[model samples]
Target: VHHGNGTEEILGSDSRFLFISSHTRGQAFYPGTGAESWKNVLNVPLSLGFSADDFLREWSEAGVPGRIAAFQPQLIILSAGFDAHRDDPALGGRLETEDFLRLTEHMVSLAWGIESCHGRLLSVLEGGYDTSVPTPHRQRGGALQRSVEAHLKGLVSSSRLPSNFTSSVLGKRKKPQCGSIASV
Candidate 1:
């Protein structure tokens, strides 16, 4: 989710793909892009200490689900970056492990809504470099393990959830007015 500029640069404006990213926004951040001026890229830039609630709100405001529905992507590629987790010191964003699950669930629901998607989702881990020495309460690998496990479990749970469940959750929401794009 952090610094998806390269992907956006590659696919942005090419209606065949819809590029969406949620990341820290500031001139100080690395690869300082994802600004509001970027066209064809749905960038949800947030300040430091952004929590899961903030993330979800931003996602909804950005009309992510409607964008997905409009695009009707045949497949979804998630550049999963866990460095945004509060425990990870590499990035300043304060997302917790459970936040990842919620985000995954939203994406899964979006995938389920589109006929072409058919739940075709691929998650490729990108960041998270908190692997260091161990402590009494927590270990170097523990956070990574927990985050990965949570993501996997969330995906499984999302897949098992009834289609009606997704409809029930998303049905009340109004359709976004954003334009559609071609399939990736």
Candidate 2:
């Protein structure tokens, strides 16, 4: 996680930050020095091979629900950048659209029951370059509506109710044996 001001704001704290980002490691990319900030800030930059599970593990260890039990955030603004997708010609990452949705889902889950809490969310486009030549996957006029729809549908289908979640900060819940409903 590459913690920064925006991430600090997103997590609603200057401390105990979790900002997951991917950038060229000190290469001659425009507006460089992405990795340099990693060590200096509250960021916990995982090396290569830090997949989504690793992120979840770190997030969990950061005392997620315990932290959220108080100081719940009202909104989540996504600084979305599709350039991380594998089909993007500019970046080297292999992140599929599903990866974005999964990450988005995780963040959304952090804001669960926002309606009851009177909260809202907004998403904005921050970075990405339009390829002059039209790629087969990329529609003309830079329309990724199809991909967005697929990602949104995947998000809905992939989401689970809170009670259905077996994971806890402590550990997984133990399941009862078959035909043992009455044992409770």
Candidate 3:
């Protein structure tokens, strides 16, 4: 139940209230932000890896209800990111897009508990440098684009699935958990 747009007009009567945003400062990517304020901001200009667990923990502490709670949200719009993927060249986030799916599922579960926002969630594209790098390997930005596309496709499929999907995927594979400061 979060929308990132800075415009008060978009929210109608609900404008200026309950809306939150966390985005890069300048127009480093597409959909430039004219926003002047943000309720929750993780403002790291270029690269700052936002780990899934970190997001969950911070959000949980933000006083909002857990991911699975019955709340009435007009709509929950997520600003999806693929640059955080471990493979992306633009960012050093190192987050697997699956983490994004898990987060999405978490929000969706919360919505399901509430009769108001059950199916009213809306997701909007924000920033992802994975799609437009300039190089030979980035022919038409195909290499990273394809990988991100695959990752996003996987995320979509996973979102439709149950939360056990995350447990199952992580259960089969084991990888070191590293925390790095640089975004890339």
**TM-score leader:** 1
Local accuracy of candidate 3 as per-residue lDDT tens digits, 104-166? 666656654565554445665654555655687745453345444443443344345445544
C-alpha lDDT of all candidate models, in order: 0.72, 0.45, 0.48
Cα lDDT for residue 19, model 1? 87
Give, for candidate 2, the lowest lDDT window spanning 10 residues: 175-184
Q: Give per-residue CA lDDT, model 2, range 1-184, as digits (tens).
A: 2223355445534444334344433333444333432321323333333455555565566454344435444554455655545455554345555676676666556555543322233556554443444578745433233234334443343243355433532157543232342231
lDDT per residue, candidate 1, 1-184, as tens digits? 3668888878987978888888887765687778763445788887777888888888788887887788888999898888777878666677777778777787777777688887778998877767545577654454555566567666667354555654654577533221221111
The lowest-lDDT stretch of 10 consecutive residues in candidate 1 is 175-184
Query: All candidates' TM-scores?
Result: 0.78, 0.49, 0.51
Residue 159 deviation, candidate 2, in Å?
3.7
* Model 1 clashing residue pairs (backbone): none
Better of 1 and 3 by TM-score: 1
For each predicted model, how many residue pairs clash, with residues at least 3 apart or on different chains?
0, 0, 2
Question: What are the C-alpha RMSDs, in order, of all predicted structures?
Answer: 9.4, 11.3, 10.2
Q: Which rank order by TM-score, best down to worst?
A: 1, 3, 2
